[model samples]
Target: MSNDGHPMKGHRFVAWLIAAGIIAASPALADTPTGAARELATKTCAVLAARVDEIPGSGPVFLRSYDSSFGQGPTAEPALANAAFTYDNALAAIALTACGHRAHAQRIGEALLSAVNLDRAGTKGRLRNTYRAGAQTQRPIPPMGWWDVVASRWFEDPYQVGTATGNVAWAALALLTLSEVTGKTRFRDGAAVLAEWTVQHTRDGQGPDGFTGGVHGYDDAPQVLTWKSTEHNTDLVAVFDWLDRAGAPGDWSHQAKAARAFLDAVWDEASGHFFVGTTPDGVTVNRAVSSLDVQLWPLLLHGALERWQRSLTYAEGAHAVDGGFDFNDDRDGLWVEGTAQAALAFRAVGRATDADRLLAEVAKELSPSGYIWATRQPSISTGLAIGPSSATDDFRYYRRPHLGATAWAAMAALSWNPFTGQRLQPVRVRTTGSK
Candidate 1:
């Protein structure tokens, strides 16, 4: 079955139905956190692999985001058709690899590498923001360039294809893992290039606050530099560490140190939480934002027991509901990706019971046919934006199955680290590696 829970056509559909029936019949199989996670991962991966459109040289490109209003013309146009975001595909590759699907992981990795567009001047080995599966005369894919907000929104760029630090970090991590899994030098070479480029662009001591957050890629028009993301820098720390562990030649100590310094500068000591990030001018942004990812990511990747406890308490009290976690403290609806990610974080921090509970909550969002919804809502909304929104209370896209969310659910189930494709286990404070 497709992610929408609609019956897919072809032999794959029949196989999927049989698989789903088996899963549904055996409630015991779905009772355990890992069992349910593996089942969902296997089933979802099969369907996603079957449905994806393969580019000749690039292999399969998973859908980045789905709009329920797809094919509905006039005011509502299809925004994400044939478009694949690098970061989403990277995460999918990690999840598939963790689930023992090396072929799928390699396919995704190759596709990402094949889709690389290196037109931007400032950065080397920079990937395009998004890639189209096939050419379309009516609405050809936008030209590759630096991130331009006006052009992006006006043109309806679905994946916001640009040189985002976070996206590149993820892509690099994915490539490194693919290299390890496939023993291919090309993938490792690709990861090294990205890592080197990232280190070059990193802002170490230039900022007023002595922050190490990297610049937010190149932007067009005004050509003004934008804010830096603490989350993205944290991701870079993990990326460099993974590359080092994989025996890549680069000396990643400096980059890792810089990334950690940026994270430290952004840490809110009193609150026991890290701030969202710093603006271009070095001022902190989103101090009031209470997002699950903002807290969970640091805890999962960089272990801080006290901070993890505090963040977990905050997430549970402020963002979590019966179904899942809200997008932020201010938002009323749950975000499926964040919830699944939080489950992994819980497991990493030795709170297996909490992790299992979260996994169970996510399991409730899965269809009998094994497709997991992006977000489960009490009712559907009439908004055009994808996923949940505060204004319209629209849940159409939220209720639909999403590639990224399902992949994250699979990752959470295995207690897999997205950075290294390793099973998550609690660790004490260490001095040997990047934290």
Candidate 2:
């Protein structure tokens, strides 16, 4: 975890130093997060931070939320709980693999594969909270209302639906990340399913202007509303980011076209921040309140920030105190859900200072027991203590994959590593007649 001789540091330094060189025609790569913040950003916080009590027969989970005293005894205790909702697990999967923990990544990958099945309707998996099958509700097409959180991951919706945000895109991203680590075609095949689902189901929720928000079109009806928001923008774009990264065959360039079209349509030509879902009242919204979606877009697409340049309103206020993000607005200071997303965003646009500023705050709040403080309130056991600090608190994202997905959190941090593609150590292969 300390400064060591490695390629990641170099990569980190390069990304962090980007702004000093641009203000002209779109360069090949402009805003890249670099330096220690860049390096540490991608490193995984050991799972020792937070601890949780699991049910005897229940599946393991990463607890995102927990009690301060956490147990019957008034002692300052810790326990693993649940996985985070977003592609948070993906962050850990990528970083762990990057740091040479391919085996651990594979284990997490298996858990992910077992968690949900997107196969044909007759043979699908069940939703985490509800009993309805994942295949039934998430197939042939995606149900749009699934992203609404409280909608219940599973319910006999008789109507069927999917959450477009992480639901539609993460399957592909996770599969791709797995493929990169293990080079397995099955993972790629799964990723393909993700691609097909989004390609066809795209218009399911999108309105006339292209960008969309809300449940899938009710029985493929006419475009009833034109809503715009970060969730709509990022999920759709990520589907393209995957296709782009997956190197899928055929002339599917239209995905990018679709991506850009949607981006331009909803890009607020004025202020930067993506709004809350577009309202039925045609309200104007552009605030710094955007969620993980805003951060993921640019991080996934190198030239994505340029989409903002077309109007001079893309994260303009960025680099501000909160790096233009409002993590502080929530009262718990930096966090796993919100700030982690912001960390990804900051790294994407080469905001090393901002990335560090945010991480530094979070790191300071981390407990030595390996738990990133679950929250900055109540017991002061925020449970997210894995950054640049040496604090102790046994409430880490590990041990709880169901509700607390630390894998992706770890991955996002490691992605900021200065040395992503290269191995820190040497590897040798046997030749036709060697050894």
Candidate 3:
């Protein structure tokens, strides 16, 4: 999103100026963790909520991603036109709500709900992937697989669209959280619709495994990518757990049971860690790639403390960087999104000191203009090129200010738990209304 204000040159510059003023006005408070988090959240939230592109009647919608040097779309073509992802907007909604920007949160939530309805026109209430200018972009990018370096090619196809289980689950979480915040049944109902669609379309039953975790979702031709994902299943488990706790209408326990079974099937008892995903034929992918998400999610969402500790230990040895965590075991440079996520996960598992250290490192990556880099480097080609030439491409890469990284950073700063929809500091609470 362009940060240009009517009188101001750009939003980034103005945001930095405001942040400087806040720091200068209260140096002591700014030095403290609470103050630092509040400052970072305020600055990042402002940039995230900036209206770079304004639709005729809808007013200004949040830009999906931005970068001062590279511009938008460094990662995907649609981002260049400021195409908003349903998942990214959901993240913004949750972060905004947690940071006490209720009005901003409501605006994002409503827009997303409208987008969902528009996309669900013929699907009988299934949520689609993305919305740009109030219309669904049926041809959206699939989920990013940073671990498999050649995976970028999968997203290069413009005709490809996916209803990723993780995306759907996250959208449901955001809607459910928004419902709690606003006392709006519409948001809850929207969440239920997504949950139902996930149950009907994503869950696989033919395999020996009870639930095939979940499919990679569907493409434009109504084709399903039959790979079952441990990460996506973990996400569903959290989603169902949240729904169960919220008293929302759904067979959450049943969903969670199947999801847990999928997770158990993928778990490597010897290593005490979960594999990435399994193909329809049951061949495992990404077994060698040490995924930060795989390491962090079980602990953060499922409360698997022993496994969490083991995974953390493995990650530190395999993917640790100077100030942040790598995207995977092979990658040398830090993945900004993964780092921010690791920080929150650390706090969730009672590693406050470790979380603080990681957050400090992540803060260093923030630009003077108040944006977070998607990664420390432009490309992760170095690590990806290590294997045989036939295995992967040696493509160059670039970095940009990613909305997902910025959102996670804000959530980490505020000690907000995305999985449980609770704050980590002082003590965890069931509802958003509590401090």
lDDT of each: 0.60, 0.38, 0.61
Candidate 1, residue 395: lDDT? 22
Looking at model 3, report the run of 10 residues with the lowest lDDT sum: 426-435
For model 2, state the Cα shift of residue 299 in Å.
4.9
TM-score of model 3 vs. true structure: 0.77
Q: lDDT of model 3 at residue 161? A: 36
TM-score-based ranking? 3, 1, 2
TM-score of 1: 0.76
Query: Residue-wise lDDT of candidate 3 within 214-280, one digit each (tens)?
Result: 3223444354556677777787887887787777887787887777677667767577667776754
**C-alpha TM-score for every candidate:** 0.76, 0.56, 0.77
Stronger candidate by lDDT (1 vs 3): 3
State how far residue 99 of model 3 sits from its true place (Å): 1.1
- The candidate that wins on lDDT is 3
Error of 3 at 156 (Å): 10
Off by over 4 Å in 1: 1-35, 52-64, 67-76, 116-123, 134-159, 202-204, 207-225, 283-286, 302-306, 367-371, 378-399, 430-435
Stretches > 4 Å off in candidate 2: 1-45, 48-86, 114-164, 202-228, 249-252, 280-296, 307-324, 327-337, 367-369, 374-409, 417-435
